[model samples]
Target: MTRISTSIIYLILFFINVRFVKNQQTTNFSCEPRPTQADTTDKLQRLRAHLVNNNLFAYVIFSEDEHGSEYVQLYDERRAWISGFLGSAGT
Candidate 1:
């Protein structure tokens, strides 16, 4: 093959290899053990009790990402600490 054509082929192959490697570097997720329903309920109840003790009518919980981005990451889920809701925006 011509040198130019060989170089182009090598360039394409290089990019494909780089992309494959990059994809491999992405985060891997596996099924992880989670809190039971009773445990979650107890946590919420305790939070309510704390609020009542403080005479607060209501309270809000917010979670922040490691980067403090407007969008919270799954690992940084604040409300999930108690409410179990995975939404980005919630009370």
Candidate 2:
């Protein structure tokens, strides 16, 4: 498929996943022991240093993989790893 078509497909899937998650009932299952403010600050500092060393301006962390699937592998949880938000709806 063309790149544009592939992108459209992914976009559609992402919206569907979002809608599904939003419609779900809430539970008391929280992502416990959320990262502290200091932890986030430290993570950002380290990430900034890495970006500078690599000559990069910024980094984009997403909650989904290439296929826009909400159910991702552990390796694909960059958003949750960095932000400590494990929700299925938003990152």
Query: Which candidate has the top score in lDDT?
Result: 2
Q: Write the per-residue lDDT of candidate 1 for residues 5-69, one digit (tens) a residue.
A: 76566566655665554345333456444755323556766775775579654454545655758
Q: Runs in model 2 with CA error above 4 Å?
A: 1-38, 73-75, 88-91
- TM of each candidate vs. truth: 0.46, 0.43
RMSD for each of the candidates = 20.7, 11.5
Residues 1-91, candidate 2, lDDT per residue (tens digit)? 9856765676666666655544554434544554553235457567757866796554656567878784799888877778666677543
CA shift of 23, model 1, Å: 53
True-vs-predicted CA distance for residue 89, candidate 2, Å: 5.9
lDDT of every model, 2 decimals = 0.59, 0.62
Report the error of model 2 at residue 4, Å: 7.0
